[model samples]
Every structure is written in structure tokens, then in C-alpha cells.
Target: MIVAPPDPVVLAGLATTRPGPAGASLLRAGLHARRLLLLKTLLVRVQRHRETVAPAVLRGFEAGWLLLERAERARPDVVRAVLDYPTTGAWLAAALTEPLGPGLDRHLAHLELLAVTAALRAGVEVDLVVDTPGGVLPLPGVGRVESGGAGRLRIDARSRAVRIGGGDGTGSRAVLRRRANGPARTLTGSGPGWRGLRALPGGATRLEDLDPYRLPPDMGIPARAAADHADTDHAGWADRWTAARRLLRGTDRERAIEVGRSVDAVVPLVPRGTRAIGATLSAAPGAVLMTPSAGAADMAETLVHELHHSKLATLHELVPLHRPHPPGRAAPTYRVGWRTDARPVAGVLQGVYAHLALADLWHRAARGSRAPGLPERWRVRSAQRFDHVHDQVVEALAILLESDELTNEGREFARQMRKHLASLSSGRRALA
Candidate 1:
């Protein structure tokens, strides 16, 4: 259960809307190659509706899309990882029912590609059974399928014998999780636990059945809001939640459990066209605020990123990572490869540490190759990308150590980071 800080005011700037397309911002800001592909997806969505899209939206989306297209062709693996994702369906459903005005620059766009990568690792598969009238819908990896009931779609997972569809009283939307395996039971949702492997949270039977009271307060994510709750009926949000929680269990169960236990609460950020898909507050420890992600992989990584913050927050109480910037000497700033924004030493440290975990995650992902149909070339490329991130982190660590920010403990921590990086590098070299 999440504990509340007394009189916790909602974090300000909860709704910062940038006018341009979210994809363009990603390109201009410079994102990792894996993420760049996701920006292109948002652009693709814009192009499909160019005639109807607003000028700012079309211009930004097209500019970013064209830039990426000219520089590189969209990889088949990247595309398949995306379009075939379960959350992509939920995101599309949300966009259709809830209109958020012009300039559809939601961070959720990036989540699509991230989900693709994560779901593949989870060993989870699904087939979208849609009820459409006319032509066969081309769903990249899944191929063409026919449907009759115009706006209705059903998601089925044969492996788990689980199906999510309309029948649980959400009207056109299917938020209820009906276990079709043995006896029929309509579960609201579940959390991080994997049955038998780990115990579920108290009172929670299904993974998608989240404890609303355990939700954090500062980040603006609603805990109690659901399909039945007015103003909280976020179309496909319920389904998206189910997919994210399940993916976490399937792909990164241990880490998910760690996060659930450490973090006080998660605040779901409404998409406001910002480049950041997720964020954690230094002021408000254990609180993570984020937009809906593209898929399970995206959610998994986002959890990793924010949970790193939670860990660091706990450590910060004990040891300082950096000394305060000298009074009046323009605070030192450095470029974070993940973002276009320049960050101070503290911010950079935060990013570097989080990315250290991500780098390692991808490194392990590259080595094992558990995901079916993942290409060899893509694996090599991913390994190279994460190695590059590791190198950057090492560099950042060096620069930080040189500065006078070390309490004996901080220096030791920095050394440990370097030691870990060196070990990972050596292991990769041996593999090569």
C-alpha cells in the first residue's frame, strides 16, 4: 500500500501542452534509435489523416517522419514489434473516443514502439479479432483479417486462454478481464505478481486488479478512476492497464515486484504533447508520473527508469551524489543522449544511473535472444546501442568524480558504477 506525504499538493505543470507534433519534438531533441522509430510511427498516423489533421500537427509530424525516412528505412522488426502490439490497439481506441483537440502530440506515441520490444520479450502473443464491414485490415505481422461488427474488436491470448472483450458492462469498451480458462470469473485487473512464482497483493486475485488506495498522490495519476467512474472513463485505458501489468509479469516480474514494493504510488500523466514519456519527482520521492506507453516493453523500461529514481531517492537521503553548484557560477550542464535538453550534474546523474540499468537490460536482451523472430542484425545493433549508452554513462561518471561533489560514500558509489561498466564491457568483448 502507498503511504501519503501530508498535504501533498499536486505537482504543478501537470498540463503542459506544446503546440507542435510530438514526433518532431523527439527528432529535434534527438532520441535513441529504438525510440526514433516510435516517433516515425506518430508521423505515420498523422500522414494517414493528413487531410483532416491540423496544419501544425501535419507539418510537425511530416517533417519528423520525412527526416527519419530519408535517414533510414523503417526496420521490419521495429514495425512488427509496434503495429502488432496489444497497447497500440488500446491507444488507437483512446484517441478515437476521447478527442484531445488538435496537435496530437502525446508521449503515448513513443510507448507504442517500446511496448513492441518489451512484449516480444514477455513471450506473449495475441490476435486482434475485429468486427469490421468492408476491406480486410492489414495488421503488419498478423496479416489481413475480416470483421463484421463495425467498431468492435476483441483481443484473445490463446497461450493463456485469456480473452478481453465486451460482456462485462463497460458498454462498447472492454475493460473487464474474463478468465476463460476454467470457471468464468470477471476480474477487474491484476498487478505485478506471477501466479505461484510470487504472491499477489492483498485482496488482489488478478494481475490487472490494482489496489486504488495504493496509488500515489503527487503525480496526477488517478488511482480510483476506472471505466465505471465518470470523467475517468478513458476509453481503452482499462485494457491498456491490463496489457501493461500482464506484460510486466511476463517479461520482468522480479523488477516489477521490486518497483511495486518500493514506490509509494504511480501517477498516470495525461498526455500533453511533451517529449518525455515519463518522469519521477525528486521533491516527491516514490511517486512516478507518466503518460500511457506504446506497449509492454515501453512500460517495463519506464518502470525501470522511474524505479531507479525511487532507489536513488532513498540513497540520496543517505549520501549526496554531487556537491551543490557554486553560488553564481552558471550551473554546469551536460547533454543527455536520451533527450535534447541540457541537464545539470544532478539531472545528468539521474539519467545516467537510470540508463545504466537500461543499458544492462538491453545488453542481457542482446545476449540471450529469447524473443521469437527477432533478427540477428537487430540484436547486434541493439547490443551496440546499449554499449554506446554504457560508454556515455562511464564518461559522465568520470566527469562527475572530477568535480568536488564526493562525500566518501558518493565516491565509492561512483567507483562501483565504473567497476560494473568495465565488467559489462569486458564480458561483451569476450562474447565478440
Candidate 2:
């Protein structure tokens, strides 16, 4: 689980919010390595806190850890997939943040569930006991098993078949079938206790995650709310995503490929009118929470914008973009033109970087007729959007350049952004 810093050229390209496929792949690899390292650190912490952890929980943790190592040795790719799942990161963050108590126990127990998922995917034998907090066993990137009560859940995986039994005296039993190469499929000939993970129709992108543990606690989106929002019109959501990807690929094939590489899962959010709301968590590198929109162009822009945040978040992990906050002093805040309230330097940087991409997106769309399906009204509006977001990005970049909170790498990144913005402005003027 060795991680390396991004190449200087890659950093510069990412600063411009246009890391090509190669750069994006590099970032993805670095982020994946970081996640694997975090998993190891978490396991070490669990071991140190064994005294506080219940005896049963401690034994379960040890078993899961051993199984994880075995699966990693047998099928590294399958184990890596389980490690890179967005929920895995969220679970790691939760487990690390929780104190030594029942809260810690509850979160640490998720590692066993993750191990079970990896074992099932790797085709390794698994006979493990995991805590089912609310009568639910969530296999990240796979589906969930819902028993009627909360207690321990027994999972046994042999060959390509898995048997799940409720350990809470409910006598609940369900069986799941797994593929020889891919993720575990939906229940086959099993009792009525679980549902499969639904995927939206995007050629190479996984567009939806309905898992209860999809989001971290700090994200403020309750599992029930996300589940409710995901329940309606998955076909409609798939149609909009297909249209959006088509529009993006038509406009810029490189960027469409980059988006598919950077974004692994889309957590659907409740929409607000015609506007699409979106958010990216720093801890979750490849996941974006976005509201579904019927407008293809709007969805395309949201995807690019959120992808910028995801990339920047991953980049910051390897490179110290901002200076550490002073021990007792509050971090200084700035007023970026896009947001109403003042924000810290990191937030400002994220906004500027994302908007820079949006500005470029609209700039190209405003000038070119490559995407014939783009609405004429949107084409007309592209100029206005370009000017508005372009100015906002310029203003935000100025703040970042002037701030003392940025490290040398951060300053260089901002300068590279300035260069990109200048190029975009020159292109706009040439069209004018």
C-alpha cells in the first residue's frame, strides 16, 4: 500500500481542472493506495483498543482481518475493489473518528462486513459473525441483507454460494449467488429478505448507490432520505444520465472519459426544482451526491463540477496544498464570488477549481456546435454562464494567490489555474 505524489505536470493539469485520462488514472491509483493504507491504520487502531472492545467483537475483528489478508493474497483485484468502494472510505473515517466505546465497536465492526464482501468477491471461504446494527447486513458495492431484528448476523461463503442467517432468534435465512468474476448478484432462490444493488445505465460509469452506508455521518444525508429519493423512476434517472454522458462525450471525449474514471458512484439526492444540487465529501474520493435532472446539459455541467471537487480532494491528500491551521487560532476566511458566506482557504480553492472547469465547459459549448443536440436556448445561455463563472473563478483565484495560507505547491497550482483561465478568456475573445 505504498503511495506516491502526483507528477508536477499532472498536478498542473489537475489544477486547471482538465487532467486527461493518464493524469486521472494516476490520481486514481494514488487515491486507491491511500485508501488501502488507511484500512491498515484502522486495523492497527482496532488492535490497540482490544481491551475496550467486547470479547466477541474483538474475536470477530481478528477473524475478519485474517480473512481480508487471505482474500488479498488470493484475489488482489477483488479485494482492492472492496477497499475502493466509497462506503469503505466512509466506514474507515467513521471508525477512526469514533472513541473507544460502543460507537467505536459499531463502526469497527463494519470492517468485518467489508472483509466478508471481499471474501465473497474473491471466492474465498467465509464463516464470520458480524454485528447487524439494525437487522441489516450491508455489503458495500453489493446489496444488503435485511433481517427483521437487530443482532449478530452469521455469514458463510463457500465456493460461489453464500448463506446468511439471522443470529437474533428470528430464524431468518437467505442465500446469495456470486459470479465467478464480477460482483455478487441478487438473491437467487433465496427467501424474501434482501434486494440487489441497482445500477443506472451509463456505458462505463456506475451511476447509482442505494446502499444504506453509502454516505458518511458528516455528510448530513440520512440513509432513509437517500433510500427514499432512490426509490422512484430509476429508469428515468438512467435515461437522463445516458443523455448527459452522450452530451459530454460529444462535446469532449477526453473529459467524458475522465469523468467516468474519476467518479465511481452517484448517490442520488432529492432534487430542488430544475436546479441540480450536488456535493462531494473529501473522505469519499470517487463518490458524488447529486440530484437527478432531466436537462442533459445541466447534468453534464454538474458531473464535471463535482468531478473537479473529487480530483482536488484526492490531490490534496498527496500534496499539502494548504498550510496547516495555527494551533489555537481560527483559520482565516475569504469571500469567493460564488458562495454567499465567507469560506476557509481550502473551501475557496475547491470552489475556484470547480468553477474554472465550469467556465471552460461553457466557454467551449458557447463557441462550438459540436453537440448538435444541445438546446439552442442553452447555447445562447452558455455565453452568459461563461462570463459569470469566468469572472467568479478569476476573483477566487486572486484571493487564493494573495492568501498566505497556501503552500508553495498550492501557489504553483493557483498560478497554473490562472494560466488556464487566461487561455479560456483568450479563446472567448477570439470567438467574439
TM-score of each: 0.44, 0.91
Highest lDDT: which candidate?
A: 2
- Residue pairs that clash (backbone atoms under 3 angstroms), model 2: none
- Best by TM-score, which number? 2
Give residue 31's error in model 1 in angstroms. 33
lDDT of 1 at 196: 13
TM-score of 2: 0.91
Candidate 2 residue spans exceeding 4 A from truth: 1-6, 166-173, 182-191, 207-209, 218-224, 272-275, 430-432
